[model samples]
Target: MPSPRPDVHPPVVTGIGVASGLGHGKDAFRQGLFEGRSVFALLARPGRQRGDGSPPFFGVEMPDPPSILPPRVERTAGLSGRAAVAVLDEAWREAGLDRVAPERIGLIVGGTNLMAREQFLSLRDYAERLDFLPPRHGHVFLDTDICGLCASQFPIRGFAHTIGAASASGAAAIVAAAEAVSSGRVDACIALGALQDVSALDLQGFRALGALGAGPVCRPMDRGHDGFLYGEACAALVVTRPELAGGTIYGRVLGAGFCADGCRGPEPNSDGQVRAAQDALADAGLAAADIDYVNAHATGTPSGDDAELETLRRLNLGHARVNATKSIIGHGLSAAGAVEAAAVLIQMREGLLHPVLHLETPLDEGFGWVRGGMAEHRIRHALKFSFGFGGSNIALVFGAPEGAAA
Candidate 1:
């Protein structure tokens, strides 16, 4: 028997699938980005204890549910879970994971503050009268429940875990999976992330904190930016060493880092964010000037956007053309990082920079930005930012395909 080589380079992203308000797949997401469409709509669920009996709220629902789902899995996971399964299935088939060794694969799913409505409703209906488990009880409402179900479907034998780091959850999952492969724990793995519709409690909380954008539109990076619009979405990527990629390689996940914001409620600062960005650049053996573009975690919030802007100005990333796609797709909570990463890869592949909608008034004159419309430019290295509540900040750096221009 020959000894395994154990790939030495950081894992690359070969396949991406998304179920978001923008659309159901990568193509739809790309189009949505180019067109700069805002999917924010009235939240169907009324806000509880928001002063007004039914507070005016904004959100984006999954444009479409999984039409073709495994009967048992569909019934088991419900809406949010099904959304995750749908994207995972697409990524699995896209990556040709069928050829990979079963035992050399792992699965990691992330969700920040998810409590699957379908799962909870089912539990309540069946167990309301029982002191314990009911005869017709379903899976309990846990963010990690989706990981076990995904692993079973894939028959993954290596390892599996779920991350619950609020908005950074998805990015954390991807980082963990990549580290696993980079460290020889697995040959390949799937990083799946899903954010279901907002719960009443979340809505009330955001409303209390004034984090939800009041207008129906999300205007990230703009001086008028107020806050982010909620969105339901799921995105998955098949991550493996570059030598093992079997499909159209989107881009390489070269480096990643995260940090905690030590600020109080609703207040965002730049020190921690800059550290994470610097760490990612260091991990990739690159400098601020090497980043050709940056997908910012603007979130349309005043404080959040201000903090990120300050972070960029402090880092002095002169070559990066920054943009925020949440102006179009809304914020996906835990799924935000993965979804934005997919957009970055798409932009790199197509050699064009997508625009940020409603960016009439730029916040700062120090950093370059992609405004107005899509700009045709090859991206060599891209940096993505994902920050969640409690000051959780994550930065991921991706490089374009070999031979591509920066």
Candidate 2:
């Protein structure tokens, strides 16, 4: 890929909002992330637990949505919908979007099949009386229901839609929003990684496929790595040109690269991952050595972690400090990319890197790993990786905000 034009300034991130197992809002997220907190527990939600009498799965579940949510949203939206609206409200306020023109704002929600639990329960409850199903179910069954909910609650009139790229949906949405802003399609855009409310069926499917872990903990990049522990998170980022930003700029979206492995399978492709990183660096007009930190997409799966490490080695980025956010937060699946992007920005702003949890022995220690505790590091440039099922791979480059300390 060719580099971006010299005169074109990359889109900047001005606001970030996150709802995760750590807690709601950016303050809780930042504190929990920097403190290396883990909240993994047995699946407790009504529809999340397996019904086969097997052992309960372990994962992180998000806290209840705040009571301040509008009554209509609270009553009508599903779990994922409520979380999306809550995060969007936080991001909108923090970005001062109340003052921005309603027609100039846009929304892009990332993720699909987000309301599986809600749908599953509804169907089971209405099986005896199908005609009595709630009217809202007609619309809420579609993933675009999140887009509609956010657009109605917020003043996003420029355009609104949802993007589904398996687990890479969040990063893909961010890249698309950056393009919209950089091309002047919208003054500012909200890229939301909507929560994936997995049903018992989803859990059983993953476990049967050997992709979901059942354990006391999720150990990403460790020699005892087995599989990923599901996590719930919804993250929103406000992207706009630096000059039009309404709040403190967190970082600049210097470049992004996305590609597919062409094979429809769960396995990751190392060559595709390498190409994505190389393309992102090229778009940023930088080399592998220029990256200061890396937020790896290590999901504790043996093959997935190995493939990413090999890609890092192939790109010669072993010198960059690397850590897995999933080790602390578990795997957010479709929301992982955007949530981890928020994690990267938070660490960059705080000048400290979070430690990986349960990484007793790294699969490969050639890379600089932030482990045991927080490490002081001012990141000037960083890379975030997000790979999804069915071969979607995304790489993003983020640079420190202008005038940031070195």
Candidate 3:
């Protein structure tokens, strides 16, 4: 950990919106998270079913997002696109961005190939009759389509684009959004983690890679941890300078760090993970001992969880309370980072840390672990870790709003 520069005034998180297996909206997510409720089940979607008569994969699927857009737009915007609008709308209204100059606002969407299931269904249904294929497929299939849809719905004219860093996409988007505001490029920016609509092919691919669990249950950090259960989720965070946000401020983005392992495989690299956390602590101008909590990037995979735990041990954050958000909601591949960031903010505001579900056996007992039920703990400074395949690792530091009591 290194000292932070005093002149750095990082962006603050003013509003957050989430849709997860817990339910839709911020309130639902907060309640369900702290209550330790889970909705995992055998995935029942049409395209999600295996064609070879194998057991269905286990996951948590969210209900279709509300039909809020115009009929024409709704027709073109598939489930993933609709989920993006639904989640971002809540954050936009909460951040009071409507009052800001349209040109001063920007948007960043996380994740690529976001509409796999939608494309899969369309191709399957129209394979014989290509003439009956929807005319809007051309516009909707591009990853940037989400960016276009969001920009059209909101008055974001400054700039808009997408970032795809595997599982770290959401964290990358947040870091980029924070920089955009800090550099005065935009007065406000929205970082959205779009839903990953995984098709049967996608699920099978993971299963083949030994990264997807075929479940009676999916547990992270436990000795029996096998693989990750795919969960459908979308989250958005509205970030701006403290002076620009007149509404309630959730927290501040103190600093962020990113690193690449140079390897192109799915294997976890402890050195890269450790460096990212250390860099984040240095950027925030705080020592490792200053951190009060950590939201770990534990995805239930044996190698992944082991690597993260080793990284934490090396960082010497034994004094900080630790928990895994994926334990309750399942894994939201691209959306995990933003959604877990939202979990961090909600816990900080409520002064209670959520419990890790089904963590019966301890992998290591040196760090403070929140288990069984919610623990009353006020977080002053927290760290969030998001690691993706291909060796992409990211770390973000968040702090309680200024003048708030600890």
Candidate 4:
């Protein structure tokens, strides 16, 4: 049957990689999530901690990166860039596209902090402490223009961009890449998103904006909710024309829908999220009841969690079990969508629904949150929602591999 949405087309996922607080690459991430692990811990920043009177910022601690890129490019980029390169390389190898012409490929990267955040923060910290000036570094700008930087690094010649629509950035990038492939503009594309290790500026910014919890914990959908715990990491996926790929099929990207609430600031609006989900359903040719699982964008902010729960309740996908990934790996800004999507694919492949960590108190009576261990279900269709600042909301629906029932 033809999908109802005009833009709907079958876009295949050829390769996937995730480097995040959960761990590097997809396998580790899947294991961590299945174990109901909490990757959150004390935010580690040496310069911030050493800086006079700077408060500590909690974040995911990434070990020193093993050599992946050559020495020339390795020294020129930040940790996020390194991670992006790693994932991109992995996807290329996985897809057996190492010999594909660069011009036939495209690159799209989603990020709120393109590498500049870390460099700027470190420069500021160094300047404050030693009154020293940073070197005239052209490489410092590499992370800022992830789209251009990645294209240049990988030598991609087609559509290249960095999307920054808050949390929706990653999902939006996926939509763009899928369109490029479906429209024949490119045979395949790579989408990557990364959030750097938390810095003093990042911590202070969220703190000043009153977005961080004073208790340093992110408890999504918990009755004792406070604010979010900021975390950092990166992820990338290789998307291609479905007919061209071979290997274990994780899931299919059925469709994507994006909407805006015209919101001016950092507050969650249930109406916008609900509309996004509705739009996605319309695109995927599925009813609300078709959704077997939902990976929610519950950020643990008192209002945000409430808003999402309210939205879900109103939408009423009664049979859909829900999991909130942020509770395990704190929100990774632009990286959130891809990470969540990766989590969903892993869950589907393993036939287990990851629990929404720390979601003890139900926001409502009817909504079901995946609590602990894996809930087994023959999930054929799933919805992943990502909402960002400015009321930008995006929803993506992934279905079972081809030949599977709806």
> In terms of lDDT, which candidate is strongest?
3
Per-model C-alpha lDDT, please?
0.78, 0.89, 0.89, 0.75
Please provide, for model 3 over 255-302, each residue's C-alpha lDDT reduced to its tens digit, 9 standing for 90 to 100.
888889886877999999988888888888888899999999999999
For model 4, the stretches where C-alpha displacement exceeds 4 angstroms are 1-9, 47-55, 125-136, 142-144, 152-155, 404-406
Model 2 ranges off by over 4 Å: 1-7
Off by over 4 Å in 3: 1-7
For residues 131-153, could you state the per-residue lDDT of candidate 4 as single tens digits? 46445254455545556546666
lDDT-superior candidate, 1 or 4: 1
Record all residue pairs in model 1 with backbone atoms less than 3 Å apart, i.e. clashing: none
Steric collisions counted per model? 0, 0, 1, 3
How far in Å is the alpha carbon of 367 misplaced in model 3? 1.7
TM match of model 4 to true structure = 0.91
Give the Cα-based TM-score of candidate 2 against the true structure: 0.98
Instruction: Give the backbone clash total of model 2.
Output: 0
What TM-score against the true fold does each predicted structure earn?
Answer: 0.91, 0.98, 0.98, 0.91
* C-alpha lDDT of candidate 3 relative to the true structure: 0.89
- lDDT by residue for model 1 (1-406), tens: 1113322366888888888887788888888888877777876642222445675777677655656566755655556667777788888888888888989999888784465454344455657655665432344366666776677677688987787667777888888888888878999888887765566666667867888888678888888888888877789988988889986888888778788778545677688888888778777777888888999988988888988888998888755798887888788888888888888998999999899888998888667788879889889989998887777778898898776663
Q: List the residue pairs that clash in candidate 4.
A: 43-57, 43-58, 43-59
